[model samples]
Target: MESELKIVTFNIGKDKFGLDIMKVDAVIEYEEATTLPNTSDYFEGIINYRNEEVLPIINLRKKFRMPDFDDKTLAKVIVLKMDERKVGIMVDDVKNVRSINQDLIDEKPKIGGIRQADFISGIARLEDGMLIVLDIDKLITKEEKIAIDEVVTD
Candidate 1:
């Protein structure tokens, strides 16, 4: 139900954020990611998970124009499947898994610094701070997905 949202909190820079776990399929540690040239900066590369070659996995840092992925700061790829297709998202750090009732989730605030605020499902007011819930499906699209047919692993 939209009212009851199962969220996975993760660090995307200094701010706290949450993603509906329902949209998540799996979380894998950053490894030797295949690189796709001429793709969006956010599109780090493709990952072979469970025998399937998924398209580009977006790095939250790059997606928000933060920083380049480095070996020092390891990240988890939050796998998401939509319309029978799977994709992934990389976060600086995986924080916690929690639940929020519908009332706790509010419309996104007018204040903005990131990209399209509409991609945010809502702001979940947790006990500690506001968790930016992401609209996974809205964050990506068929046209936006970077092709990885020729991606080479390092």
Candidate 2:
């Protein structure tokens, strides 16, 4: 039997990327984060969600070494629960959820100058366009994950 993978797609600048839908907890509006000191540039600090949970937010653009968007542009955050820790990824916009057959996804090619390529698990070829399928677990370094855990736990 052929397996199908559901992915949540989003835009960062003109490029399109996708994450396994199972990893996504919720999509929320972009909110200003409380900046923390001595953290990586990509770490956008933490935000309190509904006064219940504090999630460490990351700027994908900074992480991927992409150019920043205009301040006037509205953004959104994709919340992900990695084990006991919850992290938020800030994106330009949330595109939509899509389901693609596993066979359609191609292995990630060796590419230069794309910082986030290491985190990419595969590339899915869609009728409209190509989607870079990301492995959320590999998105951050071990040290970064530890920092996020500490931030959320505190």
Q: What is the C-alpha lDDT of each candidate?
A: 0.74, 0.87
Can you write out model 1's per-residue Cα lDDT over 1-154, one digit (the tens) per residue?
A: 4568678888877888888887888777876677766877777777677776554577778766677656524777788876656777888788878878989999887785655656787888878988888888777754674343234322
| TM-scores of the candidates in the order shown | 0.84, 0.92
Which residues of candidate 1, in runs, are more than 4 Å off?
Answer: 70-73, 112-115, 146-154
lDDT of prediction 1: 0.74
Model 2 TM-score is: 0.92
| Segments in model 2 whose C-alpha atoms lie over 4 Å from true places | 112-116
Question: Which has the greatest TM-score?
Answer: 2
What is candidate 2's lDDT per residue for 6-83, written digit by digit as tens?
Answer: 999999998999999999999999888899888888888898987988889999988888876576138899999787
Q: For model 2, state the Cα shift of residue 50 in Å.
A: 2.1
Going through the candidates in the order shown, the clash numbers are 0, 0
